[model samples]
Target: MLRLIAFAALGALVGGVIVIAVGPSTVGYTVAGIALPVFIIATVLTLIARSVGNAVGASPEAVQQAKDARRLGVARIDALRQTGTQINDQPLCELDLTVQPLQGSAFASTMRTIVPLTAIPMFQPGTERDVAILLDGGPEVAFIDEGELSPAERARLRVPGRGSVPFIPVEPHQRIVDGRRRGPLLGVGRAGRPGRIALFTVVAVAAAAIVVVPYHRAVGQSFAAMQDGRLRPDLRRPEALADAQRALEEAIGHDRVASITVAADFIIVEAPRSAGDTKTDRWTYRDGAVTHDGAATTQPESTAEQFSWTDVALDRVWTLMQDGAEQVDRPVGDALAYVVRATDDDVHSPAFGRPAGPPEIMFSVGDDYGTTSFVADADGSGLTAR
Candidate 1:
């Protein structure tokens, strides 16, 4: 039960540390997607650690040779030399060193080995010091008697061993001392089961997942989506189009619109006037945005000429009716009426019965039994009675 709690706590601590290390963008995904799975993994590892520790304890005589090797006299550091700035592509200082076994005269000559700078203790070189060197084969060298080091510091100075020349110098408590920092320790029997180390390794991998998955989603996928338009279309972009429409309405005024034309990134609205004319207002839109002109404008000084004449001019007539401009006995009827001459071209003229004047274009408010007929040109000119 305690093992399970330790595993859970370790998983939680790892998850929390990862959430903070990766910054705000990862906080949500880390908790939502990573924490539960990590807890499960840690629990399994803790159980395995305990089981393996017990198995090793049952077979103590199996590694009696390793126990004896550790009791060998310490090796002495003779000199230290900096090799280079990197090792196996890792950014760290490497060193060349010379040492000699103190009690065991195994080597006829002084021993030379290459070590990563992290393995050395915090002491000046050229002084005789107790350290450990692997007998089999290893590039690392470590101090043997560095006391009371923190976990991180101990990791750096830990010696390398294969078939067990003692993975690390034995703690006093592991022997015959009743110390406060007691077991459920990892990796060693009676102190900590080897499971603690494995549990931590699992936690590290889980924490990495929390940071990496969210970063790939938020940063990587977004950049990929930007390269292709088929990934999303204008219909999917409601916010952008809505904002552009608002800008258009504010530009032309809401009460003036007769018809609106929409495009992928632009909008055009036609507004009609009581004078039987139409004005065109246009606006452009960018994705994820809606920027309207600050000062709303019903009509600007200059506009497209082709949009206000001929068949398009009918929009203004429609706007006038929709706005109730024809209700109060206004000049809307006369403003739209026109007459045609038989001698002039009549193709463009309205079919207002028999032709009687030059061809003309005009707003058509209403046509009745011809009581008060009026005529004008396309420019609202040439008004006269037949």
Candidate 2:
């Protein structure tokens, strides 16, 4: 059981390391969410099975004694009754048997034993059968001899030998020693309590380290990234958006920006090289840095409707839609996107119809549950939810 728990903890540690290496992204959270529950369930089932086995199964000492019992004896079943117990689908029965040794008179005794399915018919009352008993131990336990008796076996049993007893006498205080009672959590044996405690302490600390170390490392790295602006920017804030716009303008070195897209973490900007150019240069601003993403082919007609960044008030649009936007349970802040571009009448929805006007801003907000979009006219007017 300890080994099983250790393996499970190792698997969890590996998963945690993978999550940390992947960083605090959607994939990391998804893997952690699935793996943590699975690990917990596996560990719980393992402990439950161990507890059940220890409760119902024989102890190590009793099993060893049974294996060591080899003296031959004869027994006739006087009566048989079920104890209303079972082990591995086999019925445990109490048997009254008259034991007949090679040299002594027969004696009647009662013993509780698990009757194998295949041997049930052979163990009926008045049936005489070969038995093996422990000569040195108490006669509380005995095993049915299922092997065919040949002349050699009779010779060995009939002749007196070393460590041979006429019959194992039943002791009044003797009862079946199933096992020593174990603690609910550890299942340690009677002796060695201090050793078990030390071992358990070590295992507990190791298991805790397996779960905590990687988590703390991941959190620390995430905090460092946030401090360095290498993580998601809070686009729901007005100042963050303004700073992104300024960064975009500085990267492009011109005010002739075509469009801007503000996402949860980063911003995308498009700007034409010249006043009437059909191709526009694209830039991606993220982690407090901007990079040119080369040129993209733009429709000449779309380029004619370009608007200045100052024409749209993103703060007003965010404020108007923030309260009405759908919320999600994830840690993804706001879970929203803002796209400012020329109005396209083709962008239609059943809830808000088509957008037909000057340049417009489309706000997409929500998370995994669902998304709600709001279309607003340039200058943050005529906000329509879709």
Candidate 3:
């Protein structure tokens, strides 16, 4: 049962990964809805089958052992204690007994067995019953005989003349044989063999649905989007920057552009929420339109100056990116355009020899490998690799 639950949990984890990677969709929800009930039903059926098996008969191995056992004699029950353990509604009991073999003297020993509710009354202390031990086995390996005896025969065995022998202790790990029988581990005897196969089939089908359903759904959706020209974006061109800036300005009704990030498939633009507002708004421009990408957040006021989009000279920046790709031997991946205040160690300081200057546009470009970065001026004046 624990193994079955573990298997079901693993299937759920794999299904969760599929949903995360493909994004939530109708097919993903349907697969989860179906797989959950299937797993529960399979677990319940396995438990029921195991219970029925326990009530039926002993395992095949126990039956073979009984065939080879030899009768020892009557055993007088001295004490019986419950172990607080149960299997299939039967309590496990530790019994103290004196085994009087037909040939040898009576010896005291301990045995552990599972007693059914119906048989508890018959196992009380001072009761005498037939017992047996396996051939080449010790007295501690005794088993209760299943056969019934007449009242006269029971009276003859109770005659008080048997000599006493020393007590022999059995190891805790040893198993004591019980007369009751139980069915096989896999099913309820031979009749449940088909049920076991059916349970396995259910589990297999559940696992397949968990894996294949989400996979085909994601593939079909992606293919459909591609055919409709909705999955691909033409944002790699230099003009995409101007178009994104214009769209963001139009949507926000302001020119307070803070930053713009250009990538192969999309462009993100950040600007102030309104004219002279400290809070910032963000938008993603894809498929030639701008959409609100995130919530507005307050930003600290800065002394740095901002540049006009017309003065960006994106063509010069693209040329520098092409040159960078040649030097790095990798294609350009993304670019970020922002204004930065001139510092004492600014790149312009080498040429102008000034401690500070007006804010200038900073262009940062990276290769597809993401291991290298190149910085350039707004007018594409200088290229420095970092």
Model 2, span 76-175: residue lDDT tens = 7768887666767887777776665443344556666678879888889877777644333334435545563445654444322212324443432233
The runs of at least 3 residues in candidate 2 whose Cα sits more than 4 Å from the true structure, single-residue gaps closed, are 1-232, 326-334, 341-356, 367-369
The residue ranges of model 3 lying beyond 4 angstroms of the native Cα positions read 1-233, 294-298, 303-305, 334-370
Q: Pick by lDDT: which candidate is best?
A: 2
In terms of TM-score, which candidate is strongest?
A: 2
The TM-score measured for candidate 3 stands at 0.34
- TM of each candidate vs. truth: 0.23, 0.35, 0.34
Superposed on all Cα atoms, the candidates' RMSDs to the truth, in angstroms, are 20.3, 13.4, 16.0
* lDDT of each candidate versus the true structure: 0.37, 0.56, 0.55
Tens digit of lDDT per residue, candidate 1, span 44-148?
665544333211121223223323455222333434444333435432322223333333332211222334456556433544344443332211234445442
Model 1 clashing residue pairs (backbone): 49-195, 185-192, 187-193, 187-194, 336-363, 340-357, 341-357, 341-358
lDDT of 3 at 47: 58
Cα deviation at 149, candidate 1, in Å, is 17
lDDT (Cα, 0-100) at 337 in candidate 3: 44
RMSD of 1: 20.3
Candidates in descending lDDT order: 2, 3, 1
